[model samples]
Target: MENLAKKVRSKKLSTRVDLTAMVSVSFLLIIFFMVTIELAKPKAMVLDSPDHGCCDCPSYPDYGENRSITVMLDENDKLIYYMGLLESPIIAPKEIKYGKDGIRRELLKRKNSLLKYSSKSLKPESIIVIIKPSKKSNYGNLVDILDEMKIAEIETYAVVPEFTPEETKLLAAN
Candidate 1:
């Protein structure tokens, strides 16, 4: 009878598992994941966009059309750019490809030209890029153009949504 009692006690002892180590490990794992997730938050790019809603917003007309260029984005990655005002352009609206040899080259060329002109004329003048994205154009194209602007170190640029009748017709015809 005593042997039987001892055997039953042994079985009860075996059944009782020590869960203290498992609990501590689980809590440590939970804490580790929490800390990792908190540290892994995504970083964002800072863009200083103009406040269009303000009535007293500054205009760039004083900068002169000579210092300005307009880039129109269309479907299928088509980029049309014109120097100066559309009414009196230094360079007429023409399709240009993207990348180092395309828009970047043009931007650099124009920037260098403006620098030379400014040095000779003794005036404050810099390249102003006006970006106009058509409805058919994708967000990726706009982002790409913005990236190009940053790559070219452009200081003044705007993303204007409105398009003139002539501009719309020009885009449609192209």
Candidate 2:
């Protein structure tokens, strides 16, 4: 034990690793990537507006009789739909439940009618639907309506901000 103690000498060894160069190289790599990386371009959904943005453009009649279906989204997930013009004597706003027997059925019925009444050359895209989401409606309501439109296989549908005052009154009355 005494010979081993005599043979042992106390000496300090530096175990510190200098990470300054490593950190500097890592920061340089990070900065290089940050500077060279290209920013991703955001994709947006294109929405069609009613106004053409040109005053000189010839204006069509209030209702073109293009055989459009007006789907009015009311509060509490209620759907009020009318065919053709809103004021047409034959067409009145009818509240229907949402499902197989709901808006999809109505749209299918209208689509079949359109196929029957319209020229044989006309395509399914000719069946236009105007979705009007009231102020009381929310994002989920709009999404549901859009989903229903897709489920019904409607190709041409426009989202309108508001409905006419008379339509509002009709919705309230119902």
Candidate 3:
């Protein structure tokens, strides 16, 4: 019995736990978390403003009854003017050139047309110009158009984003 007890006590039980599988699982979990996480992007905001007393207000109308003249700047910085509002047929300027003088000439012609259509006592202030520049349009061309609008004495102008309703909603939500 003493010999048997000695043998039993001397024998060691092997119980080694392998950590390789655990380490691999941990690595896979880390990789999955890194892959699934979404990075945030910066966005701009649009706000509704009262018609009379807000600075930096969006060019959209409150009652949807205001007159708006839309001018489009294409990807090539080409100026395309539309009289009236959105969904109106795009009207081409008499001449197509990418310069300040050309824009001024076109604006003058448009002003004259407005005068011809309206009563002689009406001022150009009744018209609201809306500039719709393409995403890839040249900044310089936009500046030129702005200058022309100023020269034409158009004070109530708006810069509208060239986006669809869904895109606008997405942007607004963000």
Candidate 4:
């Protein structure tokens, strides 16, 4: 009877699971993944100036027929565009709305015409665009116009700060 009591132990054993290492490994894996993730890059445009460095006088581009287009960015997403110069326009200045139907349509037409003349003896630098922004025009308008220039695949374009007096008068009357 003494041997049987000795065999049967009185102390009770408890079991515990340690989850500290598991949590540490999980956090490390999360940090590793977070650090390795790649972010999307922003879109940008490249602008080139027209200076050949021959003379001190900046050679002004000739405003020829079917060679240039002038766009005026006005208030409330309004665009006034004309071909040639601000004085004697190829076509008189016309007001148009933004988006696919209005400005985009005009641009596409001009692009198609330019493509047509490309097979002819036309200079590659024939299409020069002058973008004049009024004080009333917002930054969003400028971005949209730049985006449109990209969409149109315009080779050369310049952003002039202020419009001419005549252009301002035309906008006021428009």
The sequence of per-residue lDDT tens digits that candidate 4 reaches over residues 1-174 is 888877966687787899999999999999878766733345566555555686596464655656778889888888999987767777778888878898778877887787677757555444677888899999889888888888888767888887678888998987
Q: Quick one: best TM-score, which candidate?
A: 1
Predictions: Cα RMSD each: 4.6, 7.9, 12.6, 6.4
Runs of candidate 1 with Cα error greater than 4 angstroms are 1-17, 20-45, 52-61, 121-123
Model 3, 1-174: lDDT tens per residue? Answer: 878766754568798999999999999999888866743344434433346755675553432223455666766656665454334434522225655566666667666665565556544335667776667678777777777777777666777766556333333342
Candidate with maximal lDDT: 1
lDDT of 2 by residue, 20-39 (tens): 99999999999888866744
TM-scores, all models, native as reference? 0.76, 0.66, 0.46, 0.64
Two-way lDDT contest, 1 vs 3, winner: 1
lDDT of each residue in 1-174, candidate 1, tens digit only? 878777744334456888999999999999999999999998666767877677787564568788889999999999999998787889999999999999999999999898888887655578999999999999889999999999999989989988999899989999
Models ranked on lDDT: 1, 4, 2, 3
**Number of backbone collisions per candidate, in order?**
0, 0, 0, 0
Question: Model 3: which residue pairs collide?
Answer: none
Worst lDDT run of 10 residues, candidate 1, spans: 6-15
Clashes of 1: 0
